[model samples]
Target: MTQPRAVYIHVPFCAHRCGYCDFTLIAGRDDLAGAYLDALQAEIERSPLTEPLDTLFLGGGTPTQLDEPHLQRLLDLLRSAFRFSPDIEFNVEANPDGLTDAKLDALANAGVKRLSLGVQSFDDRFLSVLERRHSSESAIEAFGRCRSRFPDVSLDLIFAVPGQTLADWQHDLQTAIALQPNQVSTYGLTFEKGTTFWTRREKGQLDQADDSLERSMYGAAMDQLAAAGFEHYEISSFARPGFRCRHNQVYWNGGEYLGFGPGAASFDGGVRWQNHRSTTTWIRKVLAGEDAIGDREQLDPEASAREHLILGLRQIEGLNVAAFETQTGFALEPLGGEALSRLQDQSLLELTDDTLRLTREGRFFYDTVAADLV
Candidate 1:
């Protein structure tokens, strides 16, 4: 197998857990960070990483949750494992409340060029509802600080939040654009199972925006952001020219990547595997010189081809007809011609000589389109 061109290191430490988050994380257990780093080093040392990496991403409960020294150490350890492309887009997830000047300095010194801040909203009421620790003012300050040192800064926002109105979403988008971020990713809030928000919703303690309102809010983002000269590069992502999140594109484009740390997943040699979700279990296994992988799936060629088609369609570019055949050794139309015709008849899909792209309405029903095509 070829060497991975991208890497993702998960740092599952959070100062405080948000009510809506279902990510693999252990909030308020900052005390265990050192042990986690040690395990990370062990995993790194055991892996092979002789080729240069094009992109590197640090995601977690919050990578910025680590103290300066620990953060520095973690960055150094990961950097040492791979040869980096001269212009590697190394991104780290950060929160406004936990990013200190010292941490910024450390990140800069370690060659981190991108900061993807979790500024979920600029509305104080929404922030409180989401249980975020940072206020609107603080999040704005954090973006300013990140821009001072980083060449590329991205912001993550959520729309269709409970009790959110179209006006509220418009204001949030306006506020985000005024900040002039290199890129913005807008996601509709999801109440995943096991999250506090999910439990509250089930108990009728919390409510979600109506489906029609949710769709309208999303459509508004696409329209408003486009008017502001942002490229809707992906379904949920907008970027100023040349400012796309290359690291995430690696995943969206189905590029192979290695993942490290607890709850991280790696795809290599046609097999996808995940690490132990429990930090303690992952750390103990790594320290004991044992495999920390908990489960894996070896996908067959047909299954892999289907996945490629679905994942590729998620992008605005959709799937290139010729390239699809080259990659999967199966003509896409031959495989799903009937389904494609059905979607086209509904005006949800269109074919442009070589590219099969989603129409404007299809963007909202991408999941259905994906299922049908696959």
Candidate 2:
């Protein structure tokens, strides 16, 4: 098998857990980080690579939450495991408050070319409601500091909170564009099953934005960002001329990638698996020279084909019918030709010769379109 060209390292330490976050992590558990890194080292060395990785992404909990010494040591362990090209796109996710100048220096020294700052909103009220530690002023300040160190900086924003207004969303968009970031990812706030936000909503302690209002905000975001000269590359992502996220593209294209740390998932060949989510379990398995995978599955041919079509449509350029056939070994007609034709007639999808893509309305209801194909 060919070596995967990308790797994602999960840093599972956070100073505090936000209300809506359900990601695998241990809040306020710095002491467990050393053992976590040791387990990470073993996981990285499990499958030695003969070539350098093209892209490396350090994702969270909050990668920047690691203290100075632990941060450097984590980088050292990764460097020993895989060779990185001089021009590799090394990206790291950081919280606005913890990304101090010293942390920025450490990341730069470790060859981070891009920074994804979690600047969820420019509204202080919303930040407090979301349980985020940083203020709007501090978020912008962190962006300025990161901008000085990294070549490409991407900001993450959330919209459609329960009390958010259309004008509030517009202001957030205006403020974000003024920062002149290389990329922006605007996501609607979601209440996952296990998150605090979800439980509160279940008990009438919290509420969510209505569907109509949420849809309006999403549509406004697309138009506003486009007017600002950013390419609407993906549903939630907009980028400057040449600053698309390479690592994320790998997954969207169904390419293979290896991931490390608890709750991290890996896809190779036709199989997908995730490591144990518990920190203790992952550490014990790695230290004992045992596999850390908590679950695994082999995707069948039919399932794989459907996934390709599902993921492929996410790109702004859509799926080229001919290229899709070549890559997945199945023509579009055999898979979803009838549904596609009907949707196109309904003005939800468009088929231009060999290109199959979502129309403007279809992009808004993408989940329905994808479901129809299956």
Candidate 3:
């Protein structure tokens, strides 16, 4: 088995939970920060990696939300846990609110090369609807601060709010592009099951944007961002030249990675597993010298092949035919040619001399194409 060269550490502490979020996170849980770090250290010690990591990502709840001392400790711990390649892409996720200047300084001094700021929107109204704690002014200010510190910074934007118009969504995109971020990710709001938004939507108290409007908003993002020199690298991600997110690309390209902390999933040796979703439970189990894993999945060869194809198509570069065969030991045609042929006829997929990728129309209907392939 090949050694994993990518790592993801989830910090599950947040000041407040958003109504639309269903991620594993504990709100108002600073008290557990110490114990969480202790458990995280112990987890790393238990299965230390032998290979130098090429990329390390600190994701969250909100990693930057940690107090200065705790945040420093977490960064130091991670830095020491692995032997990193000198060019490692060290990235961290942060929220705009409560990310003080001191905290930003701490991040810069810690060798973090990239920052993914959760600005969500530059519109105060949408921010309120999304239950974000930051105002539009503050988010822009925070982006400037982040840009000053990191060579590469990514902005997150959301569109298609219940009452949001196409013009409003375009304004948000314009605002983000004006900030000159190294990368941008745009997503349409979705009401996931078990979230407050979901319950409200079910009870008819909260309305979702119509499908056509949502599609238009997504289309606008692609057009506007592309015109501004951002490469539409993936369905939801864009990057300037030389600024693609390496950590996420690891997953999309089906490479192995190590994950730690609550609800963090690791893919290694063709088996994937996730730590306990509850932060407290993960801490207790690790402290008690027991396993913290709460779930595991071992994909069969056929299932794995399908997944590889699906994830590869998510990227605009699509799948290089020879490379896919070499890596998966499965010819593309036998595995998915019939389905690809059918999609090609509909102009939803394109099969070139040595690559297979989603066509412009196919990207919008990716779920349908993936369903057929699966």
Cα-based TM-score, every candidate:
0.98, 0.97, 0.98
Lowest summed lDDT window (length 10), candidate 1: 246-255
User: Candidate 1 residues 324-352, lDDT tens each?
Assistant: 88988888777777998899899988889
lDDT of 2 by residue, 144-174 (tens): 9999989999999999887889999999999
| TM-score: model 2 vs. ground truth | 0.97
- Note the clash tally of each candidate: 0, 0, 0
| Global lDDT of each candidate | 0.90, 0.90, 0.91
Candidate 3 off by > 4 Å: none
Off by over 4 Å in 2: none
Give candidate 2's whole-model lDDT: 0.90
Model 1 residue 18 lDDT? 95
Worst 10 residues of 3 by lDDT: 332-341
Superior candidate under lDDT, 1 versus 3: 3
